[model samples]
Target chain A: MKKLLLSGMLAAALFFAGCDGTSDPALPPSSDFTVTFKALYDGQTLEKFKSYDYDTYKVNFSRFNTFLSDITLLKGNEEIKISDIEWVDFTPDSAFGNLTVSVPVKFKNVPDGDYTGIRIGYGVKPELNAKRPNNFQSTHPLSRENEYWLGWGSYIFNKVEGKADLDNSGAFGTSLVYHCGSDAVYRTYTFNTPIQVEQGAAATVEFDLKKLFTINGSWFDMKIPANQFTSNDVGNVIVATILMDNFDAATTVIQ
Target chain B: MKKNNAGWTFKISTFSAVLLIFLMLDACKKDDPPVEDRDDDLVAIPYNPKSYTIPKPEIFPEVPVPPDNPVTVDGIQLGRRLFYDPILSADSTQSCATCHLSSGSFTDNKDVSTGIDGIAGRRSSMSLLNVAYVSRPLFWDGRSPSLEDQALRPVEDPIEMHNTWANVLDKLKTHASYPAYFRQAFGITSRKQITKELAAKAIAQFERILISSGNSKFDRYLAGDPDALDDEELDGKLMFFDEGGLLGLPDAQCFHCHGGITNTGFSFFNNGLDSVASLNDFKDKGRGEVTGNINDNGRFATPTLRNVALSAPYMHDGRFNTLEDVVEHYSKNGKGVSNEDPLIRQLGFPIPGTNPVKYSGLTEYQKKAIVKFLHTLTDIDFVNNPDINNPF
Candidate 1:
């Protein structure tokens, strides 16, 4: 009789425990992190739309917009995706202005953990890339007017606009516009640097603009025959390839 | 006896607990009614929706269709009727077909189209042949986002239809067969639901049905017919498609703007028609007016040469009356305008009495060949397609 009573008590306890387990699973504590980006001219922070001298040429940028997507945080074999997709506009005319630079992107619900690296896709995700701007919501980043070339049936992933003094006359003469797109030009950059985040604390990541425009320590000349602005041409493709390669090579995680 | 009483008490408690749980589950089930009963208020109406599948031509790219406005047989029929009806105009004398004649490849041969009020428009009517494939901005000025948006403007433009949307809608609502046509096309319950948006969508559907003749000499050549074009036409084809070295000839730079099977890309460029001192000096402003950009001044969208042989007078203002004149203008390499396309600079055509001019890098014989090649793009079958003709 004592054994029967004890077994009954134990079964009741087990039933209550099972009910509690199914009611609500505990979620890992998370925090927010802000990733900041800055445009530079030869390692110096840039003033928006201002002309800067480089290698016998004076350049002034009017627009610079890029798609930074699928930002992932890595620690050994484990990975945590922080952002699905975000458009970073470096144009001075952009709405978000924090000092000279636009507002930094803040990611929420990042699980508190130690990260050893960061990865950023320089273009749109493949699934979304296949669709035209008309297919997306009007307010979506991909739906920005003039970003998608309907004739090419592709989105312009990166739009860098400027004028350059090709002859070094101190006057901007030639248009320096590089509108890079096409799925063939998409690239992902990974930075292997240690970063840690505690619950409720924010972490920051910085991208160096000087490195992005340089190759093997030499600045990429916008006036090169293959780097000129074109919507549909082999030259545009070459310029896009060089730009993506430079992005992957020059990107570094801020410690 | 006390043990028996305790056992009975436990049984009664367990029975009550089971009954309570059953009642709770029963209540949950009652919360959601059957799917059929939930929508009892909605009336069921019989609908036989007809499907339309556009014919795919050989060597042609897939037609672009807006997601919200898929082609339908009923919709196309309604659109055809609406297109031919003069009810869209303030006066009953002018219809879309009035300006766009099937014999002229859906373009009026007039330099500028005459409106219902006998007023002439600024730009000539553009050919509708293969217009559905245009991915760039619509109209010569690159205004309007899509064919649907383009359809809405002609009715209200004071220079064209000279009618208001409100008046047009009223006319459509009062028409004997229009409300029924609208119902058949869009499944609207009442004539009151007929709107300008739906009308535009229907008209766009009809416009999209106008495609090029797939049996053009160039298309036939692409489709493995070696004998389709003669040697002169073939040489012209090479010159037209040349990107510096097709036949070891100097690049005429024709294909830079008019390449691909469509023979024209969708982009606006100032081909140097006017020599303006500054961008503000351009009289027409063309694309610049629409975009409000100074650099785009005098830039006009490139028109397809598919039925160019038929749709003349040429250029945005219909300045070139003949194909020879058009070719000559290009051969002159355009008067050096401030914002002229970089590609439009001198092509080294030596003038007998004057300085070497920037021509189209084509000899007289080569220009003749290019003109012959332009003729092969004319498709006789497209202008006579029975399905695209007037329904009335």
Candidate 2:
């Protein structure tokens, strides 16, 4: 009888402890707010050209898919960690000049303070990256792409496709890939808005892509000369420097 | 009353004796080792210490380990057996050692490795020396990233071993000795336990054992032996690293790709080889096929010049037979054209009457000196060491 009583008491204690552990200490009174992300592109076009079969040219690339994730309402001077935010999937569609992307964000554990600016980058920062087990079974996109093993990637984060005026017929077309990271290209942006999401509220930052393309002159041609994407390559460095320094925060909202 | 009290004391003493025996038995039970924690009896019979010497590196972390497959004596022995055993092949005619011979810098002398059924491979075999330090993936196209992934390709490849995964597993299970070895090494008891994953791990473990870049005259000099290198070799060394004297030669821009102590950065470039008039018809698409990016076409990873003097038939195509031929290829600024990298500068001398075909500006003497310096990178101990040979 004594043993049964002791076991029963222990089981009850453990159950209560587990229940208390799960009750979220972070959630506060729910208040509503909206957040949106936007993708930008060059507004150039190539008209009066007949479309041809796509298999001839081997090298095809898309735009830079930078900005892995975004988090808001962080503590004063707190760096955003990639683990804190979940990523949204980005599929490419080049029918329009620009790809506008927006994801609503929810904030938790907010202290009463004014929040200014959102930080973003080309990919998850190396420091916060999860270690991939060196096995074949785990099938993450980064792991499956063997190119990623060679310190580079097979696809650009984003892609910009257009026709090039190479032969002067205004006919021959080429695609430009501006995705940046590592030995390729890198993109980073900081926002200008100082938002305040009081003890129980949220805020939004809207991104517009058209303004970014015209920041430097639009004549910065995207067609890279064949096999020259090194650090010292003049055109590559110029594009990389411009994108890294001032593309994200320079957005002009359309809506 | 006293006699009654003595009887009571005797009973208490007997009870204490029983309790002490119980405590001892309980303690022994608690001390028993868990099955997983016990020492494994399957340790490889250590060969004579002299016969199987482990060549220690002057620099620690000499061989890079895939954080998962650590260096274990058992694993390496198992891998060595697997490496030499032709059972990996469908016909059991070719072992890994058949192509990657220990005496030949881990590469066969053939222009391209031959596989089962007399099929010829496309490219020449690369030396496996210092593969652990390779920054990028292996192969001309930068295919497999890790050694484990790289080790499995030739086995199941149609032109190579010509074996399927299921058949290979069956072969190992049927083998009288291999099953026991696998069980001993991996603690997997079943005869049908061989899997592709385990095969890769074992082969990689053996490949990791092949690391060698020690005992060269240059290494001795670096180790503070002032008398190791002759005066001419020392002069060559000076011209190689002196950014002003060597780096001044336009073609001496060898430092850009072959820079730092490793003497080679694992980067791919077109190198003007693809600039041949018929380049559009070239069969090997190079980095473009891997990346699907147009910019990377005709590009191949730079091979290390460590044992260049010994490992002959150089480059991805293996067209240049001798070191002098290779030097001359670079001397002519490498058949420059549109897809050629910008780093390929003009090489030929400015002639008195007419323009020497614009080249990498490498004077004949400078090229010779650079080649001489490359000889210093060879590690004699690695080449001569008997312990690294396939014991089976």
Show how many residue pairs clash in every candidate, following the order shown: 2, 23
lDDT of 1 by residue, A36-83 (tens): 776655566555445677667676654567887789999989999988
DockQ of every predicted complex: 0.03, 0.04
Q: What local lDDT score does residue B170 receive in model 1, on the 0 to 100 scale?
A: 89
Pairs of residues clashing in candidate 1: B346-B358, B347-B358
Please report, in order, the local distance difference test score of every candidate based on alpha carbons. 0.72, 0.54
By summed lDDT, the worst window of 10 consecutive residues in model 2 chain B runs over: B45-54
What lDDT is obtained when candidate 2 is compared to the true structure?
Answer: 0.54
Question: Chain A vs. true chain A, TM-score per candidate?
Answer: 0.80, 0.51
True lDDT of residue A38, candidate 2: 42
